[model samples]
Target: MKICFAVFSFLFFSSTSVFAEESVGISVTATVEGHSYSSGGGGAPVPVPVVSYVSFSGYAYPAAKVYIESDSQNVASLSAGVDGLFSYEVYGITAGVHDFSIYAQDLNGNYSQSVSFFVDVPSSAITNVSNVFVPPTISVDKAEYGIKDEIKFSGYSMPNSSVYVVVNSTDGSLKSFSKEVKSDRNGYFEYAPIANVFNYGAYLVTARTLYGGVFSSFGSSMDFQIMGRTSLFASRPRCSIKSDLNRDCKVNILDFFVELRWYKKPLNKEAKKRFDFNDDGQVDLADFSIMAFYWSR
Candidate 1:
């Protein structure tokens, strides 16, 4: 029995490896071998089909990379569409209760906490797992801060939603603080400390977004240390305004030119995430006029 098990393991490990395609927002496929009947194996064994069709669909940060894992092994990796939506069909899975985990990394390089679940798949059966929302991509601008310096917390989540930022002292040298920040129409959010509300110590920060009055799970935790004497200068929040396209923190001619590329054009969900200022599903004079309001801001 032990020799048979060893031989089986060797055969499995020595098989060809498959890789995911380098494509954005597409289904992932792989090949796996199924068991077949052998006439000279001492006895006739029943054949079992290994094919299982399962699809996973969900939302994450815009243009983010979504990864899928099963039993500590990588299954598939794909990018979310511009609209923050992603779906992938996994092929060559065996029929069983398979454990799976999903996570995403936003365009800003922030990685959200993973969402895990299991699926009871039958041979030749089709199953779909949808509405799997990846948690907010979270980050801190810096890993160390002065006592009086503003700690900027930023991330991406559902557009037009409310983000809850939580700050707590990991070493108990400071009090826990939390507040609600608003996500912009494009799902980017940031909160920079405006007052000298911190002490000398190590702190942890986390964030989550509320969609339709429902809050999502808290994402991965980030920590920072406040060392040495404090600085008297208070850090000001950057111009993270929604209309600042080029991210130069200013709405000027450069931003205008970027927006004009989609001028008067029918906008898709991804395009609307950045250009659809009015949420009318179209980019026209109305959207451009709104951009005019923030010009030079």
Candidate 2:
């Protein structure tokens, strides 16, 4: 399979490239900006009402419906291409700090999480928003599973991309399973795990997509209880495991290597906060031991 990167359309006019960084649904990426006045504005220009524009380019499921709203009002929408790339320009936008919310829905009815962020629009200027990533949506077949029941999961990611599904127990037993599956041509994927979820009081399942060079954070989690042919009410929230430094829902060699880089080395504030698993203001053997305990192997 061939991987494609997003291609941006550069404007004809010369402008200063003043770049800034902002995070989308999952992780941080380039949100570059080419500062320039509106098409109607001249060297010394006046504020033109409804003359500013905002251009957005990002990735979503191929042929998916991408929608955007400004300050809770539907402003624009576009469809992603076959490579899951989408570029849209919203014209006549009044300049100011606007709250823009974006999301995507694939043809198979998978809906990504709504990502909301603030954009400061310069008067009569063009604001460009780039590197937006739409997260994959996930759902399960049932809310309750019997001991012998098979676990089924379905979601939509970028076409031909890999979907990682993870299951963890919250009744405190730490029984878990993690697997990766590929999406079909339409970015639709389904998985039925072979692992038996034994002795589970409650389990939390979530999914994320890895496409091209990027992946998203796990979407809405599904909570199901292991009942003995009887319906029961049981649910409690499970926060992300701190030991999983990479946030891939597993503490394996990938995580081990991530923490290993800082072993015994002076940690930056961010590294100390994340890699210092023991919270003792140091990255030592104890931190690695904690990661080993939550290895999820």
Give the clash total for candidate 1.
0
lDDT, model 1: 0.71
By TM-score, the best candidate is 2
Q: Model 1 over residues 124-173: C-alpha lDDT tens digits? A: 65567777777787777766676666777889987777888888887676
93 Cα displacement, candidate 1 (Å): 1.7
- Best-fitting candidate, scored by lDDT: 1
RMSD for each of the candidates:
18.4, 14.2
Candidate 2 root-mean-square deviation in Å: 14.2
> What tens-digit string does per-residue lDDT give for candidate 2 at 62-170?
8888998787677888899988888898887776778776778778665566566787677655677877777777776666766666767888777899888887887
* Model 2, CA-based lDDT: 0.70
TM-score for all models, in order of appearance? 0.57, 0.58
What ranges in model 1 sit over 4 Å off? Answer: 1-51, 172-175, 228-297
TM-score of 1: 0.57
